[model samples]
Target: MTDQKSKDPLHGITLEMILTQLVERYGWGEMGRIIRIRCFNNDASIKSSLQFLRRTPWARNKVEALYLWYKRETAG
Candidate 1:
């Protein structure tokens, strides 16, 4: 079989990378507005967001959803 991780989208992708890209594209103040999660709204940073997102699946899904939206919006 091929490299096992090659088929996985989230594999090797750290939550910090996700949050950094999203923050770079939109900034934390606005990202919080978009994602509406306390981690993004409170004293947020890559560390805090990663902690929250890793433990909370629903919030992580929302963050991923926004990342998808950002990808689509910027791709065009």
Candidate 2:
């Protein structure tokens, strides 16, 4: 038998982790500009952003996509 590794880039990563990384790299202002969601645009915090993303699929998708892009950009 052979063992195989997951190819997913976001495997084992949580929503909170993605949000934290984006905020750390871009800050709330840039995230708001990039994503245009109320949670990120108004009084943003990791907790609040997590709540919003958990409930809103579209918004969450945007955030996740941005995170993937961010990771690729900074992977060097």
Candidate 3:
């Protein structure tokens, strides 16, 4: 095996890390605009967002996608 997780971009990344970075880069206002989730809209916190994202696959996917895009954008 060639380290299966190596092929995954989110392999070693935690949900909290992703949420933190996204908030740092975009802030709640923009993040809400991008994902349209209530968690990011009203009273947003790492804890609330994490709890919501954990239960919501679609929203989590959007968050992950944004995180990946953010990483690529800032890389260059």
RMSD of each: 2.2, 1.1, 1.6
Checking candidate 1 for backbone clashes, the offending pairs are none
lDDT per model vs. reference = 0.83, 0.91, 0.94
Model 3 lDDT per residue over 35-69, tens place: 99998999999999999999999999999999999
Model 3 regions lying over 4 Å from their true place? 1-5
Q: TM-score of each candidate? A: 0.80, 0.91, 0.92
* Model 1 Cα lDDT, one tens digit per residue, 1-73: 7755576556687777888999998888998888788877789889888888999999999888887677788
Check candidate 3 and list the clashing pairs. none
Question: What 10-residue stretch in candidate 2 is worst by lDDT?
Answer: 67-76
Model 3 residue 62 CA deviation in Å: 0.2
What digit string (tens of lDDT, one per residue) describes model 2 on residues 1-76?
Answer: 9988989888999999999989998999999998899888889899998998999999999999999998888887
Supply the TM-score for candidate 1. 0.80
lDDT winner: 3
By TM-score rank, best first, the candidates go 3, 2, 1
